[model samples]
Target: MTSVNDQTQIEQETGNTEGESKDSVKQEKEMKPEESNANSPTELSKLTKIVKHSKPEQPLGFDGFKKQYYRYASKFGTTLNLLVVGGSSLGKTTFVNSLIQGSLTGKKTAKTSDFMQHRLRMTDGDINFNLTILDTPGFGEKCDNSNCWKPLANILVQRLNAYFENEIKACRQLPIVDTRIHGCLFFINPTGHMLDPLELYVMKRIDRFVNIIPVIAKADMLTPEECARFKRNIIKDLQHEHIQFFHEPGKSIEGINYGMPEPFALIGATKGMQSDSKNAIRGREYPWGVINIDDPQHSDFCAFRNFLLYTHAEALIEKTHKVIYDALRTERLNKLKSQPNGFYTSSKKLVEEYMKAELGRVERSLRQTVQDKLQEKENLLAYTEKQLEAKHKEYEESLINRCNELKSQKQSLENLVRSDKTKKHSIFFK
Candidate 1:
């Protein structure tokens, strides 16, 4: 009976151990799938979903990237997109080339025959821009020629549309391009001082498209009195048409001013290597007042390049915004005005309220944007301060370490000298 009981107990223990082994194997299989899935790239997709639905992580750490971005943005905050347009031989090509090459000498490479459209690109590190210089056919002498003015105007309109279409689309969701016509440099010869009726017609047509900047080219050919008279006359004519001018004094370094009815006085091109014209005048200047390639300062073209890049970019952005706003406002007003009397009166009221609310929202958004920019500036300043403090601390620590090392060396030297003296005295006394 005892022998039978022992065999039964052994069988029961064997069964129990086998069951435990099976359980352990099942547990390992269950955990293996989860462990493999956890290390899979597909797991990132799940994390992305969670992040999308959750609050964004705050910006962390100030570094070179942040500093560089802010520095570039601040420097180019008012970058303008400017389109230079005018009759041929009016120094449009020369002025543009000079501006880009920083001197009239470099404009030698530009083709100046008839009307040709040329595009130039300028870049500073990561910031890149293009200047489209449309050399429109000269209009005054050929204005009445239907073949000339009509085709020119049509082409101008089409090109203008295409240019703006591309610009608007590219900047549809960006903050970089904000202003159009940051300024215009319209080249008109001062020697003539007479407005070509054809030029005037073209101006009227393009005026609806862009802001006018009446630039008096070849001012060096005109006497000071003549320059003054030309400026006044141009200003008077522009004012008569209700056009405004933003002027910069001949040698002023002030921020550019906008929205004046009078034409600004700018000597777009000058003659000779005179100090006044070479150093003070901001635009491209030619040697001996020639708008041709013989000028030497032509190689220093970066200044003009910078000007075009800044102005063109700003103007493109501004103009785009204006176009959008105008279109929306006009469409809304037309729809409201088209309604029949008493028809959908409640709808009209609701629409008006909605428009007003949208306008208010835009204004509030602008205010909030300004506040955010200010906060960003403050953050940048604080970051710079912290960096400076860290550098200062590091320098102080280095200096302290250097002083301690010198102290240790000096003590070693002093001990060596004292020992040598003691040895000499002991020998002498002995």
Candidate 2:
């Protein structure tokens, strides 16, 4: 009885504990609505602040990456890499200085026979983006232009390899620095002729790796008729050679169309022209009049500048990533995979072995299939033969039984006629 009473006390204590827990849960449920209602105004205020362009105390969406990039760019700025390839005295540096509106290079710059890098730190409106220039000097000046493009090619491949290396790594604490060039401004000399050997070689060498925009330098030196004829010849040559350039074939940028789809024939603006107007502009002052660089009748300088800086600036960088870098990445990966489709042969010996093994396996599978078919046919034939024999035996037994029954009937007739003593033997025989 004492034990029973103790069990009853234990049950009562557990029931009371469960009841207390349920009561506590109900209280929490009732208070949760009030708590949420009290904080609802704060949430609404946070949302209103976000709408007014102020950051919310809590993140409400996934613009974090964009914000991070904006912060990073505002702090350290971004880079736009460009390469300029042309002959000497083509006003490459002069054109750049005029474009930048300041002296990024020296006045009396020494003639460099090698590749040179120039940088300009300037604000493009509100954005602070640095411009990097790779200028190739002594291009056609050298007597032997045989391997002049090798240095440029090597540099391009080196940058691509660096990027690919950083991409394929398992883990990286820091982001990869994009040193790949965005575009190559190929300056073609206005000699009223087709593309030259050095120009073709250089353009073709780095065309697959980088974006190139051909510029016809010194358009003021050529007559209007000569320039038109020159552009036609260049177009014919480019089509004949099957060379791919930066933009789509037969397509021009909207509102930024230069003189032609390729080779914007524009005169490089002479920096600091002393014109009649009080304000100084980048142009040439002649005895007759001053020719403005931005004048469409004079050159396509303004249009080209608008396209390069304002219109297609981001497109240039994106093509470097999506088209050129993606192509490189695919090629590298395919070479590593060793595909046997004849496009790329990464490991010749391994591909051969793999194909040989596949062929052997396929042959064995076909052989097994033929064997299985033959075995199934043989089984059906044996079954048919057995059925045919059984049918023959059954027919033979029925015929024999019929013959025996006929003989027995004949004997019965003979016995009946012999017992009758009046039956004739001839009748029985008949």
Candidate 3:
């Protein structure tokens, strides 16, 4: 009996030993994987498995982007960013107000102080583009015993520089001056045949920046022959100054006159009228004729708009891009100039060093700027997506509610129909 009992105890002990061994093996198996993972190089562990199974996200096509751009651009199209700059009292504001057929008493004139900007839209047509006319305070205005050209030029340069930098930087902080400045409509008085010294100075400054379109504003003050002669003289002067102008193809140099054609319209405070009646006079003796822009049939403003649309569209777009680039370069030069004392003792040496260092710096800066902008865009897109999702959710909820209401109405109608059928059957039976 004792032998049998000891044998049983040994068997029980063996079974217990086997069970403990199995548990140890299972624990080790689990620990081995964890140990291996922990021992593995971090980078090696991070190597993503190339599962060639997922579909790629589709990208928007060029046409899609263009369609999107066009949608936004359509809203901005009529808003022509026109900077009317010339010598004082040349009727910059007058011409602007006249174009939009608005009074210069409060809103228009008040908006224009020292370099005022006003957005004007045509009340006549839905097809008309919005015009944002920037009436720069008349250059050469007398202020505190000084001609304002120097200060104005300085201000203009600064503004130009800022505009250029913002464009290049694509800086969202600055107001976008629609890099598409269609035309610089330079207002000149026909009476003042010769360019004033200040005018000459302004013209030279303008030549550096934009494609100047000289418009003799008070055209009614001159005869057709006199207007032609004046245009020729002005063109000659501009050419002498080495200014290149965009002239219509096949249009001869003699025929290449600035400003829109025919019965030049003018807006007065009281009434507007066009004078097509030929002035029976010579150069200075021509009557100053005025025309209301309200008369769309005879309005020179319409001609101006038409000219911009058909003839100068390409020139304007091209000029805008050039202006943006020029502005950026000028700003960069100004920044370099404004650097602290002895920053560039020898320009040549500094330039060499800058050349060596700047390419890398610019590359890095560009990368960073692009990344920031892209991230911002991405954030905006994400926000927009969330908004859309919320809208969709709300719409879905509303649809569900409407469907429930419809279902309830349907049930009620069915109940009514059944009740009516039962009553008719009962009546028939009776």
Q: Give the number of the best model, judged by TM-score.
A: 2
User: Which wins on lDDT, candidate 2 or candidate 3?
Assistant: 2
Instruction: Give the poorly placed runs of model 3, Cα more than 4 Å off.
Output: 1-72, 75-79, 104-113, 121-130, 140-147, 167-182, 244-300, 309-314, 327-430
- Candidate 3 TM-score to native: 0.46
Provide TM-scores for the models.
Answer: 0.42, 0.57, 0.46
Each model's lDDT comes to: 0.50, 0.69, 0.54
lDDT of each residue in 330-384, candidate 1, tens digit only: 5444655797762333333544454466457656977999999999999999999
Q: Encode model 2's per-residue lDDT on 155-242: one tens digit a residue.
A: 7766776777677768853656778898888888888888886778667666887888878887888888888888888767766876
Sliding window of 10 residues with minimal summed lDDT for model 1: 47-56
Ranking by TM-score: 2, 3, 1
Instruction: Judging by lDDT, tell me the better candidate of 1 and 3.
Output: 3
Residue 9 of model 1: what lDDT? 55
RMSD (CA, Å), each prediction: 32.6, 25.9, 38.1
lDDT for each residue of candidate 3 in 180-277, tens digit (9 for 90 to 100): 34566777766635545556656665455555667766665565577667777776777687764534444424564434322233322322333456
Q: In candidate 2, which residue pairs clash? A: none
